[model samples]
Every structure is written in C-alpha cells, then in structure tokens.
Target: MSWIMPRRSLGHAISQLLLQFRIVSAVARRELQLRAAKGLFGVAGVFLEPLALICTFLALRILIRGAGEGTYLNLVLWLALGFIPFFMFADVAIKAIGGVQKGGDLYFYRRLRPLDSLMGTSLLTVQIFGTMMLAFVLGVSFWEWEFVVENPGRLVFLYLGIGLIGFGVGLTTLIIGHLLPIVAWVIKSFLRRILLWTSCIFFPIRQIPDEFRPFILWNPIAHGVELLRQSCNPAYPAPGVSAVYFWGWVVGSIGFGLFIYANSEELLFANEPLPGLDDGDADL
Candidate 1:
C-alpha cells in the first residue's frame, strides 16, 4: 500500500506537468494563428521590422564609410544575425509583459495560471525567432557561400540566453505595470533607446573609442551580440565579452524574476488583496 501511494504521487506530478505543457502549447498556437491572420505580411513583420531597421543602419554605414567597408551582403548577414536576437529579446519582453493582460479572460479556469501564460508567450517568441534564425542560416548555406558556424551549440545558447533575460525581466515588468501603469510606460520608453545605444547590434563595439567602452560594457545584450559575432568570425575581437559574463545576466535576471514572481503570485491579475508594483510602474 505504501509503495502504491508513492507511485500515485509521482504519477500525479507527471500528469500535472503534462497538463501545464498542453496549456502552454495551446496558447502559443493560438497566438501564432491569430497574429498570422493579421495582414498580407502576417507574422513575418517579426523579422521584417528588424530587417528594415538594419537597412536604415546599413545606409548610414555606407554614407559614412564611403565604400571602405566589407561586402554589403556580408554586412547584411552580420547585422541580421545580431539584430534578430536583439529584437527577439525586445519582442519577447513586450509580449511577456502583456501575457497576463492579454489573457486575462482565460484565467477563469482553475487549471490556468499566470505562469502558464508567461510560458506560452515565451514559447511563441522562441518559435518565431528560432525559425527566422534557422532560415537565415539555410539561405546562406544553400544559395551563397559555406556558412561558418564554428560552435553551433554555443551560438544557440547565446541566442536563447537573450530570450531568457527578456522573459525574466518581462515577468517582473508585468507585475510593475499592473500596479503602476505610468511608471512602466516611462521605463519601457527609456529601455528601448538604452538598448539601442548600448547593444551595438548593427555596429561593431570596437568602433567606439577605447575610453567609452567601459560605459556600455554593463549591457549584457552588447556582450551577447559581440560574443555571437566572435563565435562566427575570427577577425572580430570582443575582449570585454565572455560566455561567463553573458551567462551571468541570463541567470541573474531569471533568478530575480522568478523569485519576485513566486512571492507575489497572488498579486497577479485581479485576484489579490494588495497589488504590489515596481520602480517604473503603471496602474492596475
């Protein structure tokens, strides 16, 4: 009887995990379908928006360097790879922030949880961006030169690490936005410009003057983009960047977000007694 009880408990845990997974997948599929139906471009705007922005940056580079730079196609590939992950992080953070708000009505069911929505939204972002990255690699390999992927596994880790940080910060941001909307808006607005200036996605960080490097070194996204480029080309140098440095942000952001979320689970949505908030927050 005792042995049977232990087996039953384990079975129950497994069943719960399976249920959560199904819920997450369903939500991800639903969002993908809904977003895909939006227009002629469909969800491809996910990639296109970043590409357009990169093109604008490329034009600027051309005007400034006046043909002294490397091949344009090579530049596109480099910037595209860098910008894809950077934008993925940005997009995932925004989606994750709205995960609870967008699916507020769905939380009526006892089985549905705030974390489920977060996971589902996160998974959707991963799917869309992962597909785009893979497609880029395939296009380069099949149509053009041999793609140089020295450390394929490490490259993937660098990409996914950015997403995790986005998700983590997003989870915490959701709580802040719910409690104080105005502050969240301000923070969100400022974060974009900050990330843009610091990430060095389209431009190489080395181009920045030596003394100024320390100012932007704090940005993990910059470290990630730089490290990712290093993984591809031997010529590019990222002396300030390392796997350990980038991994610190990935782990720290996730740990902090999860810790805060666990303690304040009840505050999510409209179910709680007291609505807690953040530094840059909006009203619930």
Candidate 2:
C-alpha cells in the first residue's frame, strides 16, 4: 500500500516543503501593501536619506572648486552611482533586522518559515524601491549629464553583482538581529559609521593614506562601490579589485548566515512567541 502511494506524490510534497515559493510570494506581497499604505510619508522617508546625500555631495563639489584636479560633475555622477548600491546595502541591514522582529507574527502559521517570511519582506522592499532608485539614477543621469545606456551588458552585470551583495548582507543581518535584538541598534550604528568612512563615499580611495589603504581595502562595500563606478563612468580609474573577492564575500557571508539560521531557528521561536498564539508550546 505504501509502495503504491507513488513516487511522484512524495516528490511533490518534498518540493512544496522545500521551496514554499507561493507562501514566500504571498508574504512578500503583503509586506509591500503594508508599506504602501503609509503613502507619501513612506515614500519621503525612504528617499530622504539618499536625497540629502546627493545634495551634500553637490555642495561639497562647489565648496572645493579649484581645490583639486578631478572634474566635480564627473565625481558627483560617479559618487551618485556608487552610493546607490551602498544605500541599498545599508537599507538591507536595517530592514532585515526589522523583518526578523516583525516576522514573529507569521511564525504562528505552520506552513510559514521564518526565513521565508524575512526573505519575502526583503525581496518586497528590493523590488519596489530598487526599481524606483534605479529609475531615479537613470533619470538624473539623462537629464543632468546626458548619460545614456551605452552598454546594456555591462549594466546587467553590474546589477547582478549588486543584488548578490545585497542578498548576502541582508541574510547576515537577519541572523545578527535575531541573535542580538537588544544591542542590534548599537551594532548597526557602529557598522554604519565604519562603512561610511571606509567606503570612499565622499572622496576617492587613493586619497586614503598608504598605511591605512591595506586595511580599508578589506571592506566589501568598497569593492561594490568601485565596481559601480567602473560601470557608470568610462574615465573612472579601475580600482584593481578582484571580482573573486567580492563573490567570495557574498558566498561566505550567506553560508554562515544560513548555518546560523538553521541551527538557531527553533531557539528563535522558543525565545519569542508568535504574534497571535497564546499557548506556550505552540509550533513555530
């Protein structure tokens, strides 16, 4: 009787349990709707940080007129292009943390996985805001600098690299947020400061002293920024970064994060009760 149950039936059940693509998509859509409900306030809050940054970069360009050799306009465009990925990275870090905490509610649903819920929210934000940010970048480039998509191939590669880095970082942050909910704010703040200074956001990497260059070059964000600049600006100097290094970081970080999540998933549920469930021993 058991043998006659059919191998296809078992395979289908395994696929459903392993992937749960439908559940992830549903959760992602729900997250998008929740965020969209906030309307303009949500829109403004999402873009304000990046907008202020662009203004500040432009202001500095004016203040430093005649102070250096590089073209200010080129630098502004390059910085803007590079900053988009960094902003995405930072957003992932912060939001992944929030997603973990907020996702306690979904844990009550037996079919829902914690990681799937977190990933769904993360993907929702990426899909919504990522397109908007990319459009804004292209619009600004076209209107202000007359930039055009000369090489679609390179642009596609650039986006692939950026998405890989973002996913790896976001997954790592989810694990960190789950583990250290209390000090997560402090940890994020400290990392943001370090990333800002080391990422060469305001200046060229060459400007850093030789003594500190070796250490600063270890930052994966720097590699991401450099790659973005290379894709955007023809005249931009190649930073001689190894693509292997960036990909390695992506693989390593995501692997570690998944291992942590798998090992501690039950603990996460045990430590924090699901949103609606009142019983102590309810399945997570």
Candidate 3:
C-alpha cells in the first residue's frame, strides 16, 4: 500500500495547486472583464491623464526655459514615472476595500476571496498603466530627447522598488478601507494629493526647503521617484538610492495588511449588523 499512499499524496498536492491556480485565474478574468465592459473610458484614465500632465509640463517648459536648472523633459518623465504609479496603487487600495463591501452578492461564490478580488483589480490597473508608462517613456526618449537605460540592473531594481511601494500603499489603503468606509475614502483622496506634492514629481527633493527636507526624505513616494530618476537619468549626480529601505516599506505595509485582514471582521464589523439583516429577527 506504500505505492498507493504516494499516489494519493501526489493527487492531493496536484489538487491543491490546481485549486490555487483556478482561484487566481478566476479573479484575474473577472477583473479584466469588468474593466473591459467600461470600454475606453475605464482604462483611458491610465494613459490620458499622464499624457495630459506631460503636455502641461511641456508647455511649462517653453514658458520657463531660461529660469530653472532642470529641464522640463526630465520633470515630465519623473512625474509620469512617480505619479502614475501612486495613482494606480491608491486606486487599487481604495477599490480593493470597496470591492469587499460591494462584492457581498458574490460572497457565496466559494472560489473567491476578498483578497483575491483586491489583488485582481490591483494587478489589472498595474498591467494597464505600467505598460502605458513604459511605452510613453520609450516614445519620449526616441522623439523628444536622447535617453538610454545603460544599467539594466539599476533599472530593474527601480521598477521593483516602485512596485513594492505601490503594493504597500495599496495594502495600507485596504486596511483603512476596512476600518472606516467614508473616512477611508476621504483619507484616500487626501493621501493622493499629499503623494503628488511630496513625490518630487515636478521638482527635485533637494530643491525643497532645508527645514522640510528631513520630513520629505521620509516620504516613500520621494524615495520611489528618486530611485526611478537614478535609473532613468544618467545626468543625476547622486548615487543610487538604497533598495533596502524601499523593500522595508513594502514588507512592512504587507505585514500590516495581513494583520488587518486577520482581525478585519472584528474591526470592520463591530456594532454593524450584516447588510439587509437586522439584529432583530424582523426584516428592515
């Protein structure tokens, strides 16, 4: 019976792997279908918003030609790389949290998990926007300026860093989304504004006031932008940023998300009756 036992174990392992693959695939498919139904309008924000910002920067460049040491092209690139990711991550976080609440109808579907929905949506946004940003960067390089990514390693590291930051931000938003619905929405909006201002999207962190420099350095978006700049711009004088710090933020945010998920039912559902069901036996 030893051979039979081994065969059963193999079957069990295969079943588990298949289950996981199915879950991920299902989630991904639903996400794609939902976004697809929105047609161009849903996904257009990913490209159009960044392009509009780039055009505005280009115009500003013409207006400020002799004034600043930094070129408008670099600023546009920096903002695109930095700001686009922030918006993508933030949207993922907010939507993930809201998806859990809104997905009550689908809760009965055993194959789906709240995390899966969140992740699927997040992945969809990243895949759409990340591709657009890369294409824009390459197109700008070919058309507007002469630029090349000389160090492939550094470029990869930078991309990883930005991704981690996005994941962390998204996870944090999920936690907040669970805790306070309306407040979470407001906070999400405020955080996006703060990310834009502190991200060094249009200007260098070094250009900030001395008193604010220390606090600004602590901003994760600033670190991400700096890291991206280091990768894309050889003209950048400083050494590349420390990857450990960026990774730390990612890990810490994920850990916090897991912690929140573990206790989410308690934090999210305290004093709130289930939807459409009242504490009393009678229907509302």
Candidate 4:
C-alpha cells in the first residue's frame, strides 16, 4: 500500500562520487601532456619558478652573513617551508578563477564539468609543487641537517588549510569573476599582491615589529606560514598566530566559494557571455 519511492542511500551517493576520481585523473593527465610538450624540463615550470625565487632570497641571506654549515640549511628550510604553502595557495586560487574560461572548450565533452576543470588545475599545481618540496627536503636530508617536526599531524592540517583557502578563494572569485570580468582583474592585481607581501614568506611573524603584528596576523596565510615554521623548528617564535583564526579563514573561504559557485554554476556553461563583459566576453 506504500506509494513512496525507494530512498537513495548516502553510501551509494558517496561511492558514485568517488568514482569520479577517474575523470579527475583523465583531465589531469591531459594537462600534464600539454605541459610535457614544453620538453623534458617543461613540466617543472611552476615548481622551478618558486624554487628560484626562494634561492634568490637565500643567496642574499648567505651573502649578508657568511654561510656556515647549518646557516644555509636552516634558512633554506625555513624559506622552503613557507614558500611551498604560500605558492600552493596562490597558484591554485589564481588558476581556479580562470579555470573555467581557459578550459571552457573542454567542458564540451560529455564527461567534463566545471568543477572538473578546477580540480585538474589544482591537481597539476599540487603535483608539481609538492614534488618540488620533496626534492628540497631530500637534498637537505642528504646533508644530515636536523629539521625535526614537532607536530606532523598539525603541519599537514595546516598545509591543507592553506590549500583550502586557495581553493575557496578561487571558487568564489571564479563565480564573481565569471559575471564581472573587471572583478577578476581587480582582484588579480590587488589582493594577491597584498597577500604575497604580507604573508611572512621571507620572515617569521614573531620577527615582525609589534606595530605591524596586528595587521599581519589578520592574514591567515601569515599565520599559516608562521605556524609551519614553528612546526619545522620549535625554536621559531610566533606569538600572534592563531590556529582558530587561520582555520576560520579556510572554512569561510571554502564555504562562501562553494555557496556562490553552486548558486551560479549555470553561468559557467553559458557559452553566451556573462553580464560584465561589455565586449561579449564574460570569461576572465
């Protein structure tokens, strides 16, 4: 006598979603193929750029204070630790905003979706940069330098939190930028530049003068970098950093981004231009 339809199980839904891993992998493979075309070392472009920047800074540090056995190792590790996370966040966020437009042509294929494009770019970013971090760590290990981890689990969570912040910002910005091309340009020029300067990439948060600590702590990335340094070296002092606030930014960014994205996903596929594109080009 029951007229109700059978209920779909959450477990089944999760399993089905997990199956999409294949799609993610396929898209990621295509990106890798394209990058590989640049030649043998071409695939390393993203990682190399960041590593080069860090080394430039390290060279300056070495020149100022003559290199000792442990001095270069310590400085390099500290810079690497901060650089990896910040660049990961920056790279993913920036690509996420433009992922749709750049790969819009791909979504024409039945298996691809808007989120798939973002996921592919993110995967590429992580793979290249993550491998770069591993190589740097191994080089240090080869020299037998001591870089003990105080909280391995916390370090991982914090790293992921930074990545989440990037994904969230990218997602939210992609949606807004999809509708308003100018919004994307403004953010690309301003917010990212501010974050790069203030994220404590070259120095520790504790090293900052007290006058600037308040403003610096407001940047969750500053906290992320400082906390990462302390995790690598307990001697690194970071008083103003707060895990709660850092995680808050991570959660808020992802939540807001998903919310906006979900509401406006249709615009992602509208071959017709979004609103702000005066020239009939809504994609930024």
Candidate 5:
C-alpha cells in the first residue's frame, strides 16, 4: 500500500505540471494576440522593436570600429547574440514590475495563479527573442557562407540561462513592487539604462582593463554575453568569464525569487489602490 501510494503521488505531480503548462500556454497565446494587435504591423511588429534597436547599435559599432571590426565573426551575428539575450532578460524583468496589477483580471479563473501569468509572459518573450536570434544567425550564416555558432549546445544553454535569470528577477521584482510602488519605477529605469550598458551588449569583456574587469565580471549578464560570443567563435578571446559563475547567479536568483513569491503570493490578490489613485487621499 505504501509503495502504491508513492507511485500515485508521482503520477499526480506529473499531471499537475502538465495542467499548469496548458494554462500558461493559453495565457501566452492570448498575450501574443493582444501585443500583435497593439503593435505597428500586426505580428511582424513583435520583431520590429528589437530589430530597430539592433540596427541603431550596429550603426554605432560600425562608426566606432569600422564595418569589419569582428575579425573572429561577422559583426551582425556577434551583436545579435548579445542584444537578443539581454533584451529578453530586461523585457521579462521590467514587465514583471507591475505584473500583479496588470494580471489581476486573470485571477477570475480559479485555476490560474499569479505565477502563471508571469510565466506566460516569460514564455512569450523567450519565444520571440529565440526566434529572432535564430533568424539573425541563419541570415548571417547564409550571407557569409559560414556557420556562425561553433558550439550550438553552449549557445542554447547560455540563451536559456539568461531567460531564466530574467524570469527570476521578474518574479522577485513583482513581489517587491507590490509592497512599494516606487521600487518598480526605479528598477525599470535601472534595467533599461544601467543594465543595458553594463551588460556588455556593445563590447567584449576582453577590452576592459584589469582593474575594471572585475567590476564587469560581477554582472552575470556580462558573463553570459561574453561566454555566448566565445561559444559562437571558438577563437573569440574571453579571458575571465565562467559558466559556473553564470549558473550560480541563475540558481541563486531563481531560488530566492521563488522563495519570496511563494511567501507573498497572497498579497498579490489584495487589489490595493495605487497611491495617487485614491479619490481624496494626498498623492504621496
């Protein structure tokens, strides 16, 4: 009877996981539809925003280092790898800042939890950016007549790792922002500006002087970007990045974020009014 109960419990857990996946998938599809309708060119607009940003940065790269700067790899593929992963990370985390308020209506379905909505957004982001990266790489490969990624496995691992870090950061920020609305704004700004420059999106870590190298190394996103560049071009020089350090951030962020979310999940459904939204209260 004991052994049979254990098997039943295992089956139940698997079933529950499948059910959650279905729910998240449904939410993701709905989000895609809404975003597609709201953007410039229907579904194509999903790729447009990132592509425009990439083009702007590429122009800057060409101005600074000439059109043929990346001797180890094509400049297009090189920048795409850095931009795609970092954008996915920033988007996921920033969107999470007000996720509870935005997704409050989703709780109408008893089966849908707050986590599911966030997970759905993360899923949508991963899909969009992953597709963009692939399209960019394939286009560059065809143009250059050479395969861009030397280690496809490493590229994928770093790509997914960065997304996981974003999801974790988003989850953590979502809960914290619920307690203090101002924090959401601050974090969003920091991610967009500070993190963008610090994440090694525009340059490789090898160029940094020794004294500044440690500062850049502290950012896990930098490690992921540098490692990704190395993964694409085996000859690419990445001196101080490590997969172990990057994964450490991945595990720590997700673990801590999950802990916070699990504890404060009930607060998400409170539907508390924003500071300035009250009819008679001072807008503090």
Candidate 6:
C-alpha cells in the first residue's frame, strides 16, 4: 500500500505539471496574438523593436569607435550576440514587474494563478527574442560568408540561463513592488542604465581596466554575455568569466524568488478586484 501510494502521488504530480504547462502555453499564445495584432507587419513587426535597438547601438559603436576594435569575430555578429541575449534578460525581468496587474483579469479562472501570467510573459519574451537572435546570427553569418558559432551548446546554455535569471529577478521585483511601488521604479532604472552598461554589450570584458574588471564581473549577466561571445569564437578573449558563478546567480535568484512568491502570493490579489466579480455577471 505504501509503494502504491508513492506511485499514485508521483503520477498525480506529473499530471499537474502537464496541466500547468498547457495553461502557460495557452497564455503565451494569447499574448503573442495580441502583440502581433498591434504591430503593422503582424508577427514580423513585433521583432522590429529589438531590431531597432540593436541597429541603433551597432551604428553608435561603429560611428564612435569603428567596427569592433579588438575582436577578429565579425563586428555585427559580436554586437548581435551581446545585444540579443542582454535584451532577452532585460525584457523578461522588466515586463514581469507589471505582469500581475496587467493579467489580473486572468484570475477569474480558478486554475490560473498570477505566476502563470508571469511565466507566460517570460515564455513569450524568450521565444520572441530567441527567434530574433537566431535570425540575426544567421543573417550576419551569410553577410560575412563565415560560420562563427563554435560551441552551439554553450550559446544555448547562456541564452536560456540569462532568460531564467531574468524571470527570477522579475518575480522578486514583482513581489517587492507590490509591497512598495517605488522600489519597482528604482529597479527599472537600475536595469536600464546600470545593468545595461555593466553587461558588456558594447565592449568586451577584456577592454575593461584591471581595477574595474572585478566590479563588472560581479554582474552575472556580464559573465553570460562575455561567455556567449567566447562560445562563438573560441579565441575571443574572456579573462575572468566563470560558468559556476553564472549558474550560482541562476539558482540563487530562482530559489529566492520562489521562496518569496510562495509566502506572498496572496498579497498580489488581496486588494485588486477580479474582472468578473466586479460586474457579478461574468463566468468562466
């Protein structure tokens, strides 16, 4: 009977997991459709935001310093790798801050939790940015007439790692911001200004002065970005980046975020009225 009980519990857990996955997938699909509808070129136009940011930065780098001062890797590829992954992380974390509020209406369904909305947003951001990164890399490869991705595994690991970290940070931010709104604004500012500069998007870590190198390396996103470029061109010099350190941030952030969410999930919807309940007419 004991063994049967354990088996039953495991089977139930698996079923619940699959059910949650289906819910999240549905939410992600809905989000994509809504976003695509807003854009002029439908789905294709949704990509233009990131593409424009990358191009603007790439042009600034070329105009200010010429094409890739210290690297043998194709200049466009180098910047794309940095810009694409960094934006992936940034988009996930920043968008998560408001996910609960924007998705409050979703809670009318008994199974749809606030976390599901955030997870859906994260999924949509990752898929969109991941596609953008691949498209840009392939475009650059064809333009340069060379394939530079030496370690495809490493490239994938960094992309997913950065996205996961972003989800975690965004979760943490969402909880704290619900408690105190001002903190969210500060976090957004920090991510946009401080995090962006420290991420090594425009310049490699090798270019940093020795005394300042440690400060930059302290940011896990910096490690992910530098490591990603190194994954493409093995010779691309990455002096102090560590895979273990990067993973440390990934595990720690996710664990802490989950811990906080488990404790404070109620607070997110405590004061806000569900959409259908206010009207007293809507049904799931």
Worst 10 residues of 5 by lDDT: 275-284
Positional deviation of residue 132's Cα in model 2 after best superposition, in angstroms: 3.9
Candidate 1 residue-wise lDDT, 93-119, digit = tens = 877777787888778887888888788
Off by over 4 Å in 3: 1-22, 40-75, 144-147, 238-241, 265-284
Question: Candidate 1 — which residues are off by over 4 angstroms?
Answer: 1-8, 41-73, 271-284
Q: State the lDDT of candidate 6 residue by residue for 1-284, as single tens digits.
A: 67999999999999999999999999998898888898788878777877888789888888998975545578887888888888889899998888988987889997899999899989999998898888877887788777768888889888999999999999999999988999999998898889999999988898899999999999999999988888988888888999899999999999999999999999987754575575535564
lDDT of each: 0.76, 0.65, 0.63, 0.77, 0.86, 0.88
**Per-residue lDDT of 85-149 in model 5, one digit per residue for the tens?**
99999988877776767887888998899899988988998888998889988999899898888
> What are the per-residue Cα lDDT tens digits for candidate 2 across 245-264?
87787778777867877877
Instruction: Indicate the worst ten consecutive residues by lDDT in candidate 2.
Output: 66-75
lDDT per residue as tens, model 3, 1-284: 67999999999999988887677667766766665566576656545665576557656654775336345335456556656665655666556656666655555785666666666666666666677667767876886667645554776556655655565555566667665567667767766677667766656766777787776777666776677666776566433345577678767877787776766644543456667765656655
- Answer with 1 or 2, whichever has the higher lDDT: 1
Predicted structure 6: lDDT:
0.88
Q: How close to the true structure is residue 186 of candidate 6, measured as C-alpha lDDT?
A: 96
Sliding window of 10 residues with minimal summed lDDT for model 1: 67-76
In model 6, which range of ten residues has the least summed lDDT?
275-284
- For model 4 the TM-score comes to 0.84
TM-score between candidate 5 and the true structure: 0.92
Off by over 4 Å in 4: 1-8, 39-50, 60-73, 145-147, 273-284
